[model samples]
Target: MSIATSVPHPAVETARRFARSSRTHDGLRCPNAAFDAWFARQRLVNRFEVTPVPFSRLRGWRFRSDTGDLVHDSGGFFRIEGLHVTGDLGEWSQPVINQREIGILGILVKEFDGVPHLLMQAKMEPGNINTVQLSPTVQATRSNHTGVHGGRAVPYLEYFTDGSRSRTIVDVPQSEQGSWFLRKRNRNMLVEVVEDVPDHPDFRWLTLGQVNRLLRRDNVVNMDARSVLSCIPCLPDEPAGGAYGRALHEALRPGSWSLRSDAEVLHWISDLKSRRELTQQRIPLSDAAPWRRGPAAITHPTGRYFRVLAAEIAAANREVPGWTQPLLEPAGRGVVAFLTRRINGVLHILLNARSEAGCMDVLELAPTVQYQPCNHPGRPPRFSRAAEDPARLVYDTLQSEEGGRFMYAESHYRIAEVDDACPLDVPEDFTWVTPRQVMDLLRHGYYLNMQARSLFAALLALA
Candidate 1:
């Protein structure tokens, strides 16, 4: 990978703007944000059996149909007991939240007083790259969904089959809320909760290893269970601790989260992941030979190179002070980025000019690295031949990943111990795109906003 896409705050803002104009379902004519708004409108009251649940929680629960043939929300707000909502695709803002294995609404609940109650909601645990549904809520609008609540009401975990072998719990729970009741969808399903374990290291809640033992006959790596156990505060009245506790608390964040869209957050996350992966794929324009031509390339060589580039940039900053001042904040928040490389055990720089000023400074990147090169295109180069000089370099500017086809032969950069600071490398001139586009992909997956696709096109245009 060539570049590490820094946080894409701009892209994220663009995504939020696009999300506002989204619709729920086309035929249904629901705004894409309708469910989030609707769920947001409903608040979770304390100690309530059948009160409204925020849509965030309502989207994931498990339930069974009662005699009244209605849905009941037993665990939080997601599970509906009787009624069945239509297609599993109405909400596309978050794919993991909307795509329930059973259907859009996971199970059905029996209706009472013309309204449905909730059971357990099928929820996907966080930290998973993929969605692992536990319980789901059944929608009762009766659009076109066929659900599993008509027959015997079984634990929501039963719906999951490994496709290889059926997993069984050794011990069983006699009651509905028993640990063994719901089908567990992980390495270890909780068989039973252990008791009397002394609260040694400030043990306020159940431990993950205990949950793993209960669920797995053999030693199991219960990732989610460990996460949950860690989050359960030592006393519910006290603060959470330990590694697991810290991680889980951060993920859950206490209350529900609903926004016009997740475009911004996703954009930033995706940018970080994608660019990090391709770190070694970029050009190291900075460590190249100083410029004689192409006055705007990033490969200017030498201190004079930096001075000239910096001066030009500072001069530009004097014009549009607001837009350009961020360039020289003593930090590398410059609009133009670089792709660095390590060649023959030496580091080199490749500059990328994202905007107009960038286009100017980048040209000086190569030739400016070192002072004397008399316009020679070939020879042993400068730094490498300077025996016993660690601070010196050789800047034989190469246009390709393979420098054999040299662009500038003299004063080209080949710095010693350069790779230590520059772990990954990239070709210098390639247009850089932030990875946060994945969230745009998510929004586009639902087709709620056209800008999602348009934004992708704009990013692609950089290529």
Candidate 2:
């Protein structure tokens, strides 16, 4: 047996290198002082525009004659279909995005002066509040990288597709918004390369710490970038900066004391999956009752949740110059928050085992409160009041959701420190777990919801 055939594997070393990168806040390639001007310049030079249009104006897309589902002519991108769900909550029918293809969201890494740096792109999407945001090196769907849209080749895609060119650090399939996307998932990947790579005006090399700092700002880091960053392994030696950071550091440290054991947490999720009765059946878009299709949009009668609308986009930096497609426009801004409390000197966040209509697993761990304010005008989800209180909030930012598929969808992500007034005895659907427990579950797929993962990425910045 040789060293190449070692049992523990070389991936462990890759993780250690990533850990070192996370500690380096400044990089040799791009200094912290110059990042802001570079990002602003990308936004100014991109020249992105989006115009709302009627469904009839959508090019290469149509509502199916038989099923009334919204689809593309090539049938490669994705489709807007109807899902009928009956679960413990209640019975309801809503519109969901049915994209079966597993797209790739990969980040390329390299050492600059012996410190690991990531390759990030300033990408534009039609639905983004800000037209351009920091994204992964490659964020392409199967239809995209395969050139089904007859567009330019995706830049730096070979690094992800060709295994021999780069070393794989992290690769796993992660779920999107279960409520909106029907059983949808994308491949989250991180790869390292030793060879010299060319740099383009749209791309920049950033340290993990620099990326973490950007996460603190609102709508600066895209959802795909945050999702991929959350997959990086948490090292025990990372610095703990502030008062809250100290608690979080202990929570993420291996073998930290927690209120619930690892087995108990797994058992809780497993028990919910087994006991929760949820029945989902695919139906034609025409059959989705109470949702009416008008000239401008397909919307619910009350117009509370979301609507399907069409948009014409023109981008100077995309694979293609312009295209017309359908987008999901949310009714109003949403609120997703995690309520945390210090128990026995370790911080634990309150998680709800939420079951969405499109979740592959019946349920996944979600933030304490994930709801739209417009849906319940006066009434709010439990714990939201405390989470939103100015005195308790440690982290609060208005972040945008996946902009490629959504139109101007923004959510207020918050992390609040609850005092003794909030009870430790949670409802049956909720549980208390440490940050390390959540990180452990995040290594696998379909365990934590997209909002939780986004919050986790923001949480890492606090440290």
Candidate 3:
């Protein structure tokens, strides 16, 4: 709770006019300047640059054995000016490397059959500055666990179509925004940064979920890699006092941050696990947290369709081929919903949270439902596309035109899993702005669909 107690890194704060309206919390809104700049929305688009060399447009169809899933080009050298570099979402940037050095370098990534791979790596060498490497999209499989920590896991129930087998979900996928997440030719994704960080030049590689680690490492003063590069301070910003200075500052801040040591970090992690168990609430760093930035609900906008999730679908009928059946509903008004249902099949099945161009195939885990705010979204939604345009918590309980049940026309914000200097709480900057404040911000404004009086009068519940 007192982790961020000492602002180890300096923050650049300016007095900006506080908008009276808006419900999304500030901590949930943008990366904290005080916690070091982080771009939550970087992974939605291509992180690095590459020239397309379409081997063949829509090249026929289904792939064969040992072949890659994606057939795109891989030869271009653009600046690593975003998540393309350090994988920090939008603000993650990169230094331009030479064309020759930037060619794709195929590497054997751990993958199984029937999944796709997005292998990309950007490393800096003497002459190979900003050098990028990409690989043919290979099939992938989701990891066994999902969490930012390497400790014990809490168990949960998983029901399949054939019947229900109580399986303990020990391995929580430690997937951060920029963490290496891959989809199989069909099912879930695997995030591999936490498990692979130590190999990163000894803490040189920082995962999105490890923002807290980065701070702790810096404060430790010797356990981690400091972004040190001579003549390049902040990372070359522009025609003014740019990244050169800023980068230096970032790399060097912890030189005096905390008086902690490697022993202290070890002690913290060791004890932290016990503390987590004592509290039944899911810890801030578990797989359930989704603080990293990206589109809220990425569903295909083509039709009013319904589906049985990919992973669960596969489980239902792996003997046949790929994700196949079950109690699937139609997509109403295009309000795409991603459920985590258990699909019974041969071998294992994985359902992920990522969607490719609106088409989603994740397992829908219902029965245990946790509601989250739908924030800063990007997609032509079928039902609630404009839900988060304003800050208010818009909730309208109405009967569906074609239905027999009550539907909640609720406004949403992409709720992110946050863990940092402190435990997840309503940070001071935003706590003052309550539900009323949020209502005011969206009241009759541009992009805002409803006003306070009308919206409040129509709602049946408030979060």
Candidate 4:
């Protein structure tokens, strides 16, 4: 839990050089001009003429042929689906376009002179306005990693699977594409190289401090990188009177923020579970009626939760950003937050058992709040009624979501401290658990969704 005092990394200058020479666009820098041009050339055209079809007849999505019978790959990897999710908080009248893939998102770490440095990539995505941003060392779909697409294999894949030499810092399945994706998860991992490894031009080694500075900006770090970074544990050393220190103060004294105790919070959760209910049912896309059909996309009659649109993208920096593809767009910005309280000197987070139509399991533990602005019901009555000072925050930052693929991807991540003396009321759908306990549950797969995992990474960075 402690990082020893150390000097600046030797590669700090190298990282700076990479950042400076990169092409700047809307504050996001793309280090590779070819990649930028490649992305710019992409031609995104919405095909509003195509007729809507059944989920089983989803075009372009591949199905498995088991014993000569075409079947959905339920256990293979990820699948595409049409989801209609409605709850007391919000209702989506339209069928949501979703991707339920479990990809791999990993970070490579190495220590020099007792200092830890991370290897990041300046990768390009089709939906990114800036073209390229700092990404994880290894970000690839199951097909890419498995060479199904006949592309170069993901680098450092062995670091995660090879156990003899690599030391695992964090390895867990974190959710992605939360707003539109039906429980799309990724295997997020951070591993320390035990021996010397080759480096790539697209990747740069950066200190945690350097990464933190970049994270404060908009669309500078991709979602895959942010999710991986959020899992990092607290450092051994941190500057005094910083945001992390302030957040700790707020968490320790609910009185400072006019917040209730652990007991009161539990009671509120109980009330929420008792009143609100989420009901979901699977139906064929063709039968999902009242949806207006367009040549390019399928949309709800009201356009509330999301819409499926086709675009032809031609990016200057993308290897092949010039193709037409279908994408999902949400109605508003999302929020992912954690409510933390110190239990006998250890911080324990309160998590909710949330479920999505595409999730493999019935329910998985999620953050205190993971919903879009339109979907969120606002602060609970008890929390809204409580008095609070703004100064007692441990971590509060508005971070952008995935930019390249998701339309209007932005979210706020915050951690607030409350008094522990309030009533210990509990809710059937919610429980309080420590970070360590959550980490342990992560090994079970599908326990912690992507947003919760990202907050965990942010907590580590801020701490």
Count of backbone clashes for each model?
Answer: 116, 0, 64, 59
Q: What are the per-residue Cα lDDT tens digits for candidate 2 across 314-431?
A: 9999999999999999999999999998888788999999999999889889999999999999999888899899899999999999999999999999999987678888898999
**Candidate numbers, best TM-score first, in rank order:** 2, 4, 3, 1
TM-score attained by model 3: 0.20
Which ranges of candidate 2 are over 4 A from the true structure? Answer: 1-16, 236-238
Measured against the true structure, the TM-scores of the candidates, in listed sequence, are 0.15, 0.96, 0.20, 0.67
Tens digit of lDDT per residue, candidate 1, span 265-320?
34433443333311111112222223221222122243221211111111110111
Worst 10 residues of 2 by lDDT: 1-10
Ranking by lDDT: 2, 4, 1, 3
Q: Clash pairs of candidate 2? A: none
Q: After superposition, how far is residue 189 of candidate 3 from its true place, in Å?
A: 14
- Candidate 3, overall lDDT? 0.18
* Residue-pair clashes, model 1: 116
- Give lDDT per model, in order: 0.20, 0.88, 0.18, 0.55
Candidate 2 vs. true structure, TM-score: 0.96
Candidate maximizing TM-score: 2
Model 1 per-residue lDDT at 226: 22
